[model samples]
Target: MPLKLYKRGKVWWISGTVHGQAVRESTRTHDKEVAEAIRVKKEAGLVSDHVFGPKATRTFAQAVESYLKAGGDARFIGGLDDGLLCHFYDTPLKDIQQNDLDDAARKLYPTAQPETRNRQCYTPFVAVWNHAVKNGWADVRQWSRPKKPKGTNVVRITKRRAGTFPVEYEHAARFIAAMSPGPAMLMTTLFYTGMRPIELFALEAGEVNVTGRWISLYKTKTGEPRGIPMHEFLVPIFTSLLKRPGLDKEPRLFRTPRGEPYEQIATDEEGRGGGGLKSAINGARRRSGIKDIAPYTGRHSCSTGLVVAGVHPHIKDQILGHAADDMSRHYTHVPQAPLIEAINKLPVPDAWHALPWLEDPLAWSGRLAEGTGRRTDLEKRREA
Candidate 1:
C-alpha cells in the first residue's frame, strides 16, 4: 500500500513506487527505524502534489516548464539552461563534475560572447538546476556552475568608433540628436526615463501622462508594472513624439518603421523575427560611427550616469527595474539625462575646459576609429 520492507545482507530496505512508477531503492540503513523514516519522507513527497496541490510538490522541470509555457509560447528562460541542456542533459545529475562544467564552458568560450552565453545559456541552466535542487528533484551538492573566468580578457571587446562616446551617454544629446526623428525621440525617452527597451516597446499610447509627467511601464523585467516619474527633460520630447499621427492608436507605443507592433526581439522558431528595435543601439552605433556599443550600453550608461549624478543606487535600481545594485551591471534601465549630463560635464574635447573629459575622449575616439574606414566614408558621404 505505502512501502514494503525487506532485508538484504543484514541491512533493512524500504521500497515503493512513486507517481505510478516503480521506485524501489535500498534505504541503506542497518536499523529498521531509520528505514521506516526514509520511507515515510519519500511517500509523503509522492502524494503531496496530489493532496496539497502544485505548491506542495512540483519537480524542477515541471516548474520551469510551467514558467516557460505561461508566456503564450514566448518565454525567457536563461541562456545557461540552453547550454546546460545541450551539454549536460544526457547524463545523470550526479555525473556532472567540474571537468564537465569546464568542458562546457570551453565549448561556449570559443564561439559565444561571454556576456551573451553567460546570461542566455549558463545563467539559465544554473537557475534551472538550482530550481530542481530546491524542489528535491536533484541533490544540491551535485549541481555545479561554470567557473566564469575572471577579468575582461576572455571577453570580445568591440571598440567604439572615433568621435563617438566610448560610453553611449557620453554624447547623449548628440546620440539622440543624430537618431532619425522617430528613433531620436525614442532614444531621448529611453535615456531619461531609464525604461528597459522592452518595457518601452510594450507601452500603450495612453500609458504616458504628459500633464502628470509620468509613464507606467507594464511587462517590466521585474514581472511587475511600475509607474516611473518622467524626467522633466523627457516630457516635452515624448509629448511631441506621441502627437505624431497614426502612432497613437497602436497597441504598443513603439513600432517598426514598417508599422508592426513590437514583439520580443529574439530569434524565435522562424528565425530572428521582425522589429529590429532590440538592436536599435547597434544600429545607432552604425549610424553614429560608434562601434561595439550595445543596447545594454545605453542601460549601463544610464545607471553609471545616475551614480555619478548622486542619484541613490536604490532609487536608480528601482528606476531601471533592477532588483539589486550590483546586478544592475547585468541589465538595467539606462538613464539618458543623467548619463548625458555626466558625459557633458567631462571636459569637452578641447583641453581648455576645467573638467577632465570623463576619459580622454581623443584616446577613446582613436580606439573606436581603428579599422572603421567604411564608417568614416559613410559619415563623409552623409555630410557631403
Candidate 2:
C-alpha cells in the first residue's frame, strides 16, 4: 500500500507500508498541503532505500546517533552537532565533502581562529564521518582542516590561560598557605607529583601506597598506568591524611571541605582536565595576592623545579609521566630509585618550611571537623 495521510485531531498523521516496511509517524502540521509534501518525501525516501539499500538514505544525523550509541566521547561532539544537524539533517552522508565542511566551518564560526575552527567544527565532523565510513554508510575521504596562517604567530589573550605557567616554590608555598587545608594538601600533592588534575581527582585511597612511598595511577591522559614516587614532603602529609578516621571506607583519597569527592573531570579543547577546585583556588589566589596561579601552575612549577635542580631530562620525563623514547619504559622491572632521587631534588624553599601544615599535617583536620560537626585529636588537644 502507498503512504496515506489522515487527520488525527488537528494534526495530519502518516501511516502506510512502503517497500515491505511499515511506516506510521506524524507529519506534524495542520496544513493539508504541507502534510502531503512531507508524506510524499517520506515515501520517496523509503522507495530509494529499498532500491539502493539503506546507505543511500543514511544522514549525518544518523551517523552521529550511531557513533554516540557506540560509546564515542560526546563532550564536544554533542555541542558541535547542534549546528551541524541544522545544515545536514536531511542531507545524505555520501553527499558531504571537504568543501562542504570548509563552508560549514566558515558559516558556523566566521571569526573563530583556525585552531578553534579545527577543534570546534572539523574535528567532530571528521569523527562522525569516519564513524560513518566504518559502518559502510559513507566512503572514506580525507577532509582538509583549517590551518593557521604560515609564518604568523597567533596569540590569544584571555583572562584565564589554559596551559601551564612558570611558578616558583616560594610563590607556590604562599599560595598553598592561603588555601584551606583540603585544597592546600591537594595543591601540595600536585606540586610534588606533577600529576594531572583529572588523575588526582580520580585518585582512590587504595591507589596510594604510603608505606611504599608510591602513587599508582591506573588511568592517565596518556591511557597508560603511571607510578609516581611520593616526595619526602608528601609522605608525612599523605600518611596523616590516610590515617584519618573512616577513611578506610572512602574510595576517593581527596574530598572537599564537606567531605564529598571531587566532581567529574571536564576536558577543554586542549584535552586537559582540571576537575573541580576552581572556587577554592580562586579564593586562594585573591588572598595570596598571586593573580596568575591556576591549578596547572603546580605541574609546571614541578617540572621547572626539577630542571633547575639539574636532574637529567630522562629521569625528569619519567617522574613527570611524559612519554619516553627509550625501551626502558616498556620493561616492567624498571627501577624507581632514579625517579625517586630526581623528584627529591626539587628544592623546598624557606617559605614552605614556614607553613603551619608542615609541623602538623592534620592542621586541616580542624576545618574538616567544623564542616562535618566532628572534632579531631588536635582540636581536642587544644581544648584540653
Best by TM-score: 2
Per-residue CA lDDT of model 1 for 200-262, tens digit only, reads: 667776777767665655565444456565765555455555654576455565544444565
Clashing pairs in 2: none
Model 1, position 154, has a per-residue lDDT of 75
**lDDT score, candidate 1, position 289:** 68
lDDT of 2 by residue, 91-155 (tens): 79878777888998898889998878887788878877877887888887878888867654756
Tell me the lDDT of candidate 2.
0.73
TM-score of 2: 0.62
For all candidates in order, the CA lDDT equals: 0.51, 0.73
Candidate 2, superposed: residue stretches over 4 Å from native: 1-74, 79-109, 114-163, 267-274, 312-314, 324-335, 366-384
lDDT of 1 at 119: 50
